[model samples]
Each structure stands twice: as C-alpha cells, then as structure tokens.
Target: MNILIVHAHPEAQSFTTALKSTAQQSFEQQGHQVEISDLYMMKFNPVASQDDFTELNQPEYFNYALEQRNALKQNHLAADIEIEIEKVKRADLVIFTFPLYWTSVPAILKGWIDRVFVSGLFYGGKRFYNHGGMAGKKAMLCFTLGGRDYMFGENSIHGPIEQYLSPIQRGTLAYAGFEVLPPFIAYHVPYISQKDRQDILVDFEKYLKHLDELQPLKFPVLENFDEKMQPLN
Candidate 1:
C-alpha cells in the first residue's frame, strides 16, 4: 500500500523524528511505498496570505514562493497532497506522524493542511459522505507528547490532549473522508530512556507491519469523527 507520513518537529534527533524513522524503515522493509513531508526539514512556511483567496472570479491560483501567496500549490500537490489523497483513492490507509505541540499539531503541519487541502482536491459541495474528493480514504495519527500522560487528563495541567487534537482527528482528516482508526498516542516522550525509545521504535515498526493491511478511515454518523469535534485549542 502507498502511505504518506507527514512529520513536524525541528530536531532530527528528536523522539518525534525517531518515530518517523521507525515508520519509514518499517514500510521499506515491508515493500510498501511511503512518502514523507518533513515540515521542519522542508522549512514549510506556516503563514497564509491573500493570494490563496484572490477575487472570486480569479480562479484561485497558488504560488508558495510569494512567501504569502496564500498557499503552496505546484510540487506539493503532486507530491504531498496527491501522495496521501490519491493513496486513499487508489490504495488505502494514510498515516500522519508528528509530535503533539501545545496540545495540537505543529503550526507547519496545519499549514500543510491549509495549503494542500484545497477546493476540488480534497472537498467540494452537495454529496455529504464518501462522495467528495477524499471520500473513501483511511487515516491515522502517530504522535509523541512531552508531558506525562497524566498531564493530559481532564483536570491536569494541559487539559485533555486528545480533546485538543479533535480538530485534526475530526475536522481536517476525517472531514476529508479518511476513516480514522483509534489514534496512536505516545506520551511522555521527553522522559523516556534510550532503551525505552528503542522499544517504542520497535513498537512503531510493529504498528506499521500491522497497518500494512490497509483500510479506509471514515465514519457515517453525527457522533462520528468529522462533524462533531471542536476546532483547535
């Protein structure tokens, strides 16, 4: 199966990068086609601009070099955008790997969303379920968190982290029509031992091996993943 792994986080030696590395190695070993968009490594611009809008009749053209053209179009569309979306259309299963930041996805990954998920590409009007641009895809999240798992509890210091990422789990990916599996959360990243890190890496390999089967990530009702979640915190 074809897989798209979008990674965010600056440090190449970070636990987050380690996770991405594990995922990549796993897929390669299994002979699955995998593509990665390392947000920091790519130096993906996080801000948006007016050209992404233009006049209503201007036909919404995109150019990333503008540093503010509203969005990135060319290369990424065929690469990042098409990689996962088409993998959904042609194959099955899309996985996103990142580090949970401020209880949400890193700003650059969000920017990837804003830039790539454009009209007539991932969504459109009329048909509500499974009929739009990305109706039948499957998606999952694999992320590492800095604070202890307890810190994400209801009354903890950071509030509910799972709840915080609902926009990504529900609004963005699921809205695009990928059936989301139970998100794989790796908590307490900053506190792990070298051995512990290695173990998680091994575990990630196992996750990829199992995920190799491939399936669509979608839901059909109101309490479902897409329509019911609130926006990012």
Candidate 2:
C-alpha cells in the first residue's frame, strides 16, 4: 500500500517527530511506499487565500479570495495545502500525526485543512462524490499529548481525545469520502519515559501493519446525504 504521513510538529527532535519517523520507517520496512510531508520543517504556509486557487494553467479563472485572506497571511497556510493535495492524490492511506493544542490541531495543521479540503476540488460538483473522488482512500490520526490520559476521559478536564477529532473525522475525512480509522494517541507526551515511548513504538509498528492490510474507508461525496451521490436531474 502507498501511505502518506503528514507530520505537523516544528522541532525535529520532538517526541512527536520521533513517532512520525517511526511510523514512516515501519511502513517502509513492510515494503509499502511512504511519503513524508513535514509541514513546519518545510516552512509550510498554513493560510488559505485566492492565490492558492490560482491556476497557472488556467490564469483567467484566478480566484479572488486572496484579498479576503490577508488577515491570516501572518501564518504559513496555503503552501501546505497545495503540497498536501498533491501528496493525497498519490496515496492510498493518509496518516496525520501531531500534538493536540488547545483541544484542536495546531494552527498550522488546521490551516492545512482549511486550504486543501476546499470545494470543487475535494468536493462539490456533479457526480463529485458518487463514492467520493478520494473515498476509497483511508485516513488515520496519531497524536501525542502533554496531559495525562485520565484528563482525556469524560469526567476529566479535556473529555475524550476522540471527541477532539470530530471535525477532521466527520467533517473532513468522512465528508470527502475517506474511511476513518480509530486514531492512535499517546496521551502523556511529557510523562512518557523512553521505555514507554519504545513500547508505544512497538505497538505503533503493529498498528501500521494493521493499516496496511485493512480495506479503505468508503464514503461517497454528496452535497447532501438525502440526494444520490451520482448525477441526477
């Protein structure tokens, strides 16, 4: 299987980076082609603007949302999206690895989603989502957290970590026709000792193998579920 690992952490030495490498390495060892797109190290722009939609091939249709996006220009937004779209087009499995921040993805990663998962391209067209253009693709989220595992529980401070990914899971992946797999999370980034991290890596390798073998998730692209995904009158 061809897999794409999208990593968003900044520092290469961070534990999150290590996990990203481990996941990629395991997939390669298993003979699956792996693509690693490092958002920050690549100096990714996480902002979305009309320039993003600009078609060098079709200049006349240059989009106008660029002017409306200046407020977000301070962040590197659209560059990541443009690159990720290409990577997504190449993979069968797309895995997102990052740390949860303020109960959501880091701003840069969020920006990646905001830009690439746009209309017309990823969705919104006649017969756009019969089975979802990318519907047969698979997606997974892997995260490392600074808080204790207990804090992510229903009675704890943050609620379940799974709840944090609802938008990416339901709104993005599912909406785009990808199957959502249970995310792999390591809750106490600061607290996990080297031994624990090692064990997690071992478990992670097992899970990566599982992902390689599993069937892709299926969801058709539809403007609305009530309507048929295919063309209609």
Candidate 3:
C-alpha cells in the first residue's frame, strides 16, 4: 500500500523524528511504499491567506472557501497545496507524527490540514463523515508527550487522552472520511531513559507490522442523521 507520513517536528534528533523513522522503516520492511512530507525541512508555510490562490473569485470580499473552490476548479491552487493534495491522493494511508503541543497538534501540522484539505478536493457539500471525499483512506497519529500516561486517563489531572485528541481524530480525520486508527503515543519520552526510548521504538515497529490487522475507531454513518444533521429517531 502507498503510505504518506507527514512529519512536523523541527528537530531531526527528537523522539518524534525517531518515531517517524521507525514507522518508515517498519512499513518498508513490510514492502509498503512510503513517502514523507517533512514540514520543517520543506519550510512549509503554515499560514493561509489570499496568496494561496492564483486569482481571487471575489476580489472585493475574500471568502477562503469560495476562493478555494474556484481555485481548485480553475487548477489555480498554490503549488505547495497542489503537491500535498497529490500526495494524499496517491496514499492509501496517511500517518501524522509530531510532538504534542498545548494539548493539540503543532501549528505547522494544523496549517497543513487547513491548506491541503481544501474544498472541492478533500471535502464539501454532503461529502463528509462516511461519505467524505477521502472516504476510503486511513489516517493514524504517532506522537510523543512530556506527560506520563497515567496523567491523561479519566481519573487523572488531564482527563482521558482521547479527549485531548478528539479534535484531530474525529473533527479532522473522520470528518474527511479517513478510517482513523488508534494512536501510538510515547508518553514521557523526555523523562524516559535511552533504553526505554529504544524499547518504545521496538514497540512501534510491532504496531506497524500489525497495522493491517488493527481495527479503525468507530464513527457514526451519514445515514444516522437526517437532512438537517440531527440524529434520526
């Protein structure tokens, strides 16, 4: 299967980078083709603006969604966005690797989502959730965090880890129609020993090797809702 890894850490030697490398090697060992988008190395611009379009749809009032749809139809999207879209189109699975920042994805990665998951390309109209533009694709997250695993559970200070990740998993990936996988998280990486870190890498390899056998997170189907988007009785 074709796989795309979107890596968003600034430091090459960081634990997050190690996880990215581990995933690449593991997938390749299983004979899967892999591609990586190293955002920092590529100097990917994370901000969205009028500059993203070759020409504006409404020059008087800039509505990003309107401009994006127009640009996509005109084949006038920004070069970088076009490239990213092509990568997503080719990949059967897309993995995101980053360090947790402020209880969410790094700004660069979030911007990547905003810019690349464009209207008329990734999602629009009734094409969302199970019927989204990217319906058959899969997405997973691999991240490292400074906090201990226990700290993120229901009875802990930070609450459930899934709560912190719901925005990305459900709002972003699921909304785009990706079959989201359970995340592989390396908790307290900075506080762990080198041996522990290596062990984590080994475990990550095992996870990748068994990726095909893993079940995706469950989500509601479009049929579950009525035209107004309320759950049908």
Predictions in order: lDDT: 0.66, 0.72, 0.92
Report residue 36 deviation for candidate 3 (angstroms): 0.4
> Where does model 3 exceed 4 Å of error?
224-233
Ten-residue region with minimum lDDT total, candidate 3:
224-233
Candidate 3 per-residue lDDT over residues 182-219, each given as its tens digit? 99999999999999999999999999988889999998
**Backbone clashes in each candidate structure, one number apiece?**
5, 10, 0
lDDT, residue 203, candidate 1: 77
Off by over 4 Å in 2: 55-82, 125-131, 212-233
- Candidate achieving the largest lDDT: 3
Give the TM-score comparing model 1 with the true structure, all chains together: 0.73
Quote the positional error of residue 201 for candidate 2 in Å. Answer: 1.3
Selected candidate, larger TM-score, 1 vs 3: 3
* Worst 10 contiguous positions by lDDT, candidate 1: 67-76
The predicted structure with the larger lDDT, 1 or 3, is 3
lDDT per residue (tens digit) for residues 21-75 in model 1:
8888887788878777787887776655543433223335534433222222333
